[model samples]
Target chain A: MRRLWIGLTYAVFALLIVVPLVKIATGSLEDGVSGLLDALLRPEALHALMMTGIIVVFVTLINTVFGVMLAIYLVRAAWLHPRIKGLLNSIVDLPYAVSPVIGGLMIVLLVGPDTALGALLEGAGIKIVYALPGMVIATLFVTFPLMVREVMPVLQEIGSQQEEAATMLGAYSWYTFWKVTWPSIRWGVIYGVVLTVARTLGEFGAVLVVSGNIMNLTQTATTLVYQDVENFNVVAANGVALVLAAFSVGLLLLMEWAKKRKEVH
Target chain B: MHIEVKGLSKSFGDFKAVQDVSFGIKKGHLIGLLGPSGGGKTSILRMLAGLEAPTAGDILFHGKRVNDLPPQERGIGFVFQNYALFKHMTVFENVAFGLKVKKLPKDAIRERVQSLIELTGLKGFEHRYPAQLSGGQRQRVAFARALAPEPQLLLLDEPFAAIDAKIRSELRTWLKEMIERVGITSIFVTHDQDEAIEVADEIMIISKGRLEQKGTPWEIYKNPETQFVAEFIGESTTVDNVAALHGFEEAAAWTGTRGLIRPEYIEIGKPGEITLASATMRGVVRHIHFRGSEWMVELEIGDIRLITYRSLEKDVLKPGDPVDILIHRAYLFNESDSWIMENKLKVDPMPVII
Candidate 1:
């Protein structure tokens, strides 16, 4: 019975994951490599991929720095009243509660081109709703909780003991954080960064809605795939998706490595 | 340095962890903040180390107020309960951390860290991470790391609590000897009376967030001034009526109904081994159990059961046999006061001093 269940699990995994991955890989090479290359070489696909890369870099960097700070503040700030901290902590997972499309819609409703603040920013010569900034913000909103979720537990587990020990030994606060706290949570931070990057790469609904899906300006790879399928260009969609799926697989491997390293201590 | 805490108190929300605790440490004295769990010993230690801000009162180091001094400038070393050795750093790096923070000369850092590693007997394991070390080794690393910056004062919170039973006693002796050799004024918090008595030059007993008593181990043991101190310090059992016991029946020193008897205060012997004159208290052996180096004999005088220890080298006695008991002293306590009551039949009554 156990063997039967185990076999069933693998069969389900192959059908849902392995089979789709193989199909994407083969479908991208339908014209014996020209199809994948032609689709990737198109100016729109390149621009979309580049835009996605930019958003992933921006979102991951911004989220890693602020997410780690927020985690530290939530877990270690003794001055913050526990009640307020608890309220803030409970709100960290708001990104997960609302669907990404709804999150994108919220941003659009608050700061779209037609909104008063959006028009003022446009009059000031800054474009957000159909630009890189809005795209990054949308992805940031979606991936904001990943870094905090990963690092918070690590910070709480290590506690303030080593930091206090450092302080007693005459290390300053920043010095203690650098020497004591950072090293303990570095792997957690790495895990957070990878998760953020993965989510940013795959973020479609939020980025598409917030950035107005503007081709060559705001279209991300996932958004490009959606556009390709809508235009009945299935081969191009497969090519872009296979590239995205390949990066996701690499990040999955990185996550596995980080997890093993995390357990070393 | 002479450290003094004046009316130090701490409260966590509504829970008062430390309440109006005040004490002074003479130079180079090893003090132990001994208490049960949640009795505010650790809170008091943290306040002294400037790790926890006092809810009220002040801390003085060398007669200067250090209430506002951050822990980095407090010139103290602190070892946490679980050692808190930096898991990511090697033993050498852990010891060198303080020096590095101070931006010492590289040569000086190396020399100091090497000497501390050697001093902690971790000479060869300098490059090993904390995860690679045993609990005892990790504690040694924490100790070495704490001492790296050459702080004037040291603090430890349950330093031996993480180690297993066998290594704990050895670490206690090692820690005490190291503290003496370093000649640094240090305070450690622990719940184990044995550890406190073994390591601390003076033990401060804490209960209910209050400092109950403070004295040398012998002073606290022989001259417990309170009922809590009497019953909490050692292997003592409270008695309902001490007046019913032989030798103490007519002693004028006792003025209360409640009394505590320590195992060491009573001696048990076989019938033939005791003199008839000294064998005023005849007790029937109720149960006998083999204790480590002694035989734990429970005896009954009338209806009252008492516990006493007999050396293993003595003649063994079985249950229901009549035996001789000689109680040297017991702590007698009333509602307000406690004092030592001696057996009038065993020894001359001497004035008890603290």
Candidate 2:
């Protein structure tokens, strides 16, 4: 009886998540699977796909550079005040707690038009909100934690010994980092990049609010899928959703394969 | 190269690990930094290697101060206690690591690494990783890696500690010969007294981050300067109140303490009139231990227990036997009980020295 109850609970939870995806896949395939493929190949849908790709690429690049720096800084600069480090580390997770709508609202309130910094940026001809830059900002906010979390543990584990050994071997600090320190954490950094890419590609809530869901200009696949669902175009929504899911799953598999290769070596 | 350390000190927060340590090494001598655990021997070595900065002192290499130099620039090799081999590199790669860092020509690097590997007896295992090798073999690889750079001074921190006793002995013999052949100024730290005695040209005994004594192994063993050094260097049998005699007054005055007799100095003999004291107060023999070529006899001499070794050629003394013992040549000391000159009793000193 206990096993039955546990199985029932798991089944319900799994179905709650899986049913929507199954329905979307089946709905997209009903009018011949080729129709879903054709919809994906359409110019508008292709443009939306291109925009999402660009967002993922740009956001991942920005997050990788900053995340690696943050990890190295935290590990090497132990003399920094503990409370300050704790504050900075806790701030990395702020995006997770804040609702996507609230995050978008905060960004708008800080950088949209009313704030001094927003006005300065606007005066400099940089349109942040309701633009590609705004989309990048939202994606960066959500995916920042992924890379930092992945790389920090690896940096901590490798510790300062190898770096010190390299220094003792006559290599300059930068050379030691590149030759000795980087090799040890290369796989970890790659894993983090993969996670950041996946998160950026699928990011919906914040991007939807910040990008203004502008069709052909700022409409990402996630936002496009939302538009399709609202317009009752279930098949189109399912097609876009399936593409995002497939991309995420592929990246996850790549990360897992890299991890296994590391273990083997 | 000769190295001199003067007034070197290091502190970790409120605790001082090494304090006012000053010593020097002659060129091409294999010195052992001997001490109990936590004696700051490794700290002193690290300072000399420039891995650590002394709080207040200077290290001179060949009469030039090198306190501000980095480890690589200091041109000293260090072998960590765990052998610190790069796990990701093969033996050849590990040995070649230093050469490559120096940016030597490819052929020179190859030749130097190969020569070092051959010198360390690691010719056949060039392709293996450190994890695949045994403890002794891994240590050899570490030695080869450190020596590849042809460092001015080689520092080994407890080099043979990870190996078993039998392997440790064999490796120590091999290492001593190799270091001598190279004639590199070398310093090795160990808590094992026997290792220091066997390998070092001079042993610097440290206690509680201070230098207790520094001398040749024979000098240290036969003539320890302090109580800690006496107990640490070799096996000793300490006895209290053997009753001072008038003939030992001069020797006692020089030592400023009481007298002590080494086990080997005490001989069993027939009682004679010249005997200082009779072996009157005696207790039962407590134990007789066979120590290879000799027997160690423990006797309850009155309220005090005394230990002495008897040769195997003589009749084996067993427990419960009553034997007459004599102190043929005992060390004399003054009121403070410090070791003084030997009370020769007209015996030759050649046998004792040998």
The per-residue C-alpha lDDT of model 1 at residue B344 equals 72
Q: Write the per-residue lDDT of candidate 1 for residues B1-354, one digit (tens) a residue.
A: 898889989999999999998889899999999988989988898888888899999999999999999888888999999988887889999999889988999999999999988888998999898888999999999999999999999899899888999998988899999999999999999999998998899999999899999999999988987888888898877878788887777634546567799988887777656653452678899999998888898889897788888888778889999987877787888877777877776653453467
In the range B75-192, model 2's lDDT, one tens digit per residue, is 8777888887777779998888778889999999999988888889898999998889999999899888888888888899999999999899999999999999998999999999
lDDT digits (tens) for residues A135-196 of candidate 2: 89888888888888877888788667556655556667777777777877788888889888
- State which docking tier applies to candidate 1: medium
Candidate 1, residues A51-145, lDDT tens digits: the string is 99988888988999999999999999999999999999989999999899988888888778899998999899988888898888888989999
Candidate 2's TM-score on the B chain: 0.88
Question: Given candidate 1, what's the lDDT at residue B34?
Answer: 92
Report how closely model 2 matches the true complex, as a DockQ value.
Answer: 0.40
Give TM per candidate: 0.91, 0.84
Top TM-score prediction, candidate number: 1
